[model samples]
Target chain A: MSTIVVFVEHAAGAPRRGSQEALGAASALGATVVAVLCGNGADAAAAQCGKFGAARAVVLDATAWSPDSAAIGVAALVRAEKASAFLASATSSGRDVAPRVAALLDCTLFSDCTALRKDGEKLVVTRPWLAGKLDATLRSSAPVLCATLRRNMFAVKETGGTAAVSKGPALGPGKAVLEKIEARAGGKLDVAEAPVVVSGGRGLKEAPNFALLEDLASAFGNAAVGASRAVVDAGWRPHSEQVGQTGKTVSPQLYIAVGISGAIQHLAGMKTSKVIVAINKDPEAPIFKLADYGIVGDAFEIVPALAQAVRKIKAQG
Target chain B: MKIIACIKRVPTTDLQPRVAADGKSLDAAGVQYMTSFYDEIAVEEAIKQKEKHGGEVTVLTIGSAEASKEVREALAKGADKGVILVDNAWGGRDPLATAKTLAGKITELGADLVLLGRVGTDRDNASVGPMLAALLGWACVTDVVGLELGDGKGTARREADAGTETYAFALPAVITCQKDLNEPRYAGLKGIMAAKKKPLEESPCPPATSQVEIEKLALPPARKAGRIVGEGAAAVPALIDALRNEAKIL
Candidate 1:
């Protein structure tokens, strides 16, 4: 059977959900699924991989490596894994590193794949574009195939695979350095990772209107607040919270877009969210075309109502 | 100093792209083309760098000769020259293949630095700069909003998972521009006239055979039509019900 390697990404001493999602995607490769990890909690991450689908796991302590250098360092370990197909979650770091791995391996790669399956000894992948209006099916002829998978596309289950753990050598000196990192949001509660996102737009009118969204997000508790490019440009929100062609592309379990008119740019960022609910006064709003549920109304009235309902539900449940 | 900027010719974001007669490709007849938005920022940054650092900025693109329109657009905004790389080998090629071709041209030109859009609007992924950097053995940064050039190094601030991070890179770096990096300038009448006088070069860049290929392209399945559960505050209860019971999200 072909050997598949899944890259496990970690943060603050635990495996990130995307890695588990990647591991879940790798399970269907039906190969000897090997998990590879680096950075702060490689050992812990490897152990976590065991519950997903890993048959074997390798660890490399990459404390000093930046995302750019990590690609080079982990690629060295991946070479030893002899992965016929390599998989990673399509996060910022994962997207940054996967192509470098492919370049190091002298093969081509795919990104943001929503699905992958074997086809007569080859693998075919599917990715979306045009704000999910177009889908592209792709194939690679390279001996080793590598892909960055879309978030939450594959579901993980406890498989009790009992992966055998191993250690890899540390990386030597590298050219690129991490330098300094300034985080806009505290606690790593990134909009990209949140299960639910409450996004606001120009329809919200002013910056204070965001407080209503903050209340709704607080009701969802685990949800993050996002902003469309227009509001962000208007200084209604920070760039970190912006979601559109120029901002973070998110795929959450549920996305509630308040007052977003659904420009192609805005839709391009969040169309992948599994369930979308748009609240807009305009019935012709393009967002409704992409939303799973539509509420035709003003945000000032609808959002407060949503907050009240969500608060009551949370209080009771 | 020699600098290269990679630009892409993409359909205007406002236009709705339709499948051509082939049913697998975007219709070309009425698709208005422009320099990919982020790439325009790259070109603008290159111009600012050239003005301050006494260097020439060469805008490079990989597409049909029709990309000349985008090249002139870049030149009008202040690039010194333009080069279009067209190849039958590169038709429908993926990012990795495109990067390899750009790497070859960058090496051939002996570029001191390279700039590209953080992500091209078409195909919309941000991998080309890093892949090309890997091929060239250079430091690479993406989503860069702040940049400062130095004697042999540069500093850049880019968006990260939670926030933005600042990085120091040695020379010969590949830095991709994000929005807000700079205000891309519009071409004035004089600038447009001068752009027509700028040297535009075109060459057939016979890229290596691509390993990855698109098999088919189709309209994504339409999102299901949704009912307007109710109007205002009264509808909020039904919405909550849908979220909690039907969608099971709550």
Candidate 2:
């Protein structure tokens, strides 16, 4: 029987949603799922992982081990347990760690996997390649398979199963240290985690003009601000704010593209958004083809009007 | 000072993609390819650093023969030389194995600084650089938007969740350029012509081993058609109602 290890990623005592998604994926494989918790709050993470259907939660309590250290430890655990597969959430931390673990274990790794299944004695994982343009099915030659599940690709359910929490031997000191974390101005929501997003492009014409996108996002109250690759390259916004094949891949509940002529690269990142709205003066813009709701008008004119309209509606409520 | 930049050639993301008949890879029949967006930034950063510090910039890529075009693109953008590691067997290898192969070649080059895009545009794994650093036993900083190098050490700013993190590391490190690191220069006609004369070497390495495999490939389920509740501000109430009740996101 193959055992699956899910690396639990957490910050400030709370586990990320992606961790639960990995747990969900691990469960579907019918493998014994174990959560590997590192850093300070291992106990809390272990408990949460248990609620999410991990059969066992292993706490590698080492103060010196940063998130990166977990990669080495995971490799050690995989060897020690003789686990057949390992799973992780495709977050920044997981992306950093899972590959190193795979390298150390001399195993294959499938990243940003959208689905998984059993193919005879081997596990087959499906993942997007070529910026969501192609889906690839991969099979591992090694008995141990590793994968990182994309966020929001799978539903995380509370299985309510009791997990056995155990403590693993400390892996010793790590090389890296977490010095400090500085919050961005106004503490905007993470683009990867936001439920809604409002993006702009070169069509916005100027930097200050992004206020229109801000207004729409403010109206949504839970939306993050994003930009097309062109806009970001033009220095209209921070690179972290860009949404596209090379930037952040977001699958929000609503993605509003203002003054944006949808480029294929731009569409690859947010095409999975649940509700797509495009506002562009060019009625023939490619964005219109993917938009569930499209408005053909000058973004400069339509944006302010839309903002005022949403403000009035919110005030009424 | 010596610098190395690893780049990749990826399809332009703007085109409609068709899956291969085997359902396990991109058809790549009619698609256009370009240097990945972040790789452009990586090459630009390398050039900028070379200009300021009087160093040499060597761009590296691991792919098939077609990858030479991307190397030529980077050479036109001011890289001093190019190295293309081509192996037919590495066509669909995972990121870890790719990193190992690249790291081996980079280790052979003995660069003082190594640079890469935060992630490939196609894979978007954002892992190879850091993983390479780990494998090479070098300090690694990823998602670097800004960088300043001096006297065998450097400081870099990287994006994180809801914030930014700045770190200082010694030379002989690997850093992945994020989108905002620097604006990449367009290849002028002169540069394009000059690139033909630049020295580019091609070498093949053993295919790195992969442990993770893809099982099946399919397009995500298509979204259902959405109905517009109304138009203008009048539509606001219905939008809110639908968000609260129908979508249940509110």
Give the winner by TM-score: 1
lDDT of 1 by residue, A1-317 (tens): 47888878876655678888888887877788888787656787787787888888887776665656777766776687777888888877787778887887887778888889889878999987654556778888886888888877778767876789888776555556667877765453578778899999989999998999988988888889999989988988877788876677788999999989988878877887888999998888988888888889888999998898888888998
- lDDT for A168 (candidate 2): 87
TM-score of candidate 1 against the unseen true structure: 0.95
Query: Can you list each candidate's DockQ?
Result: 0.65, 0.44
Model 1 C-alpha lDDT per residue in residues B78-186, reported as the tens digit of each score: 8889988986444477777789899988988888789999887777767798889988889888788899888998888887676777877788899889887988989
Candidate 1 residue spans exceeding 4 A from truth: B21-23, B88-90
Candidate 2, residue A79: how far the Cα is off, in Å: 2.2
Docking quality category of candidate 1 according to DockQ thresholds: medium
What TM-score does model 2 achieve against the real structure?
Answer: 0.88
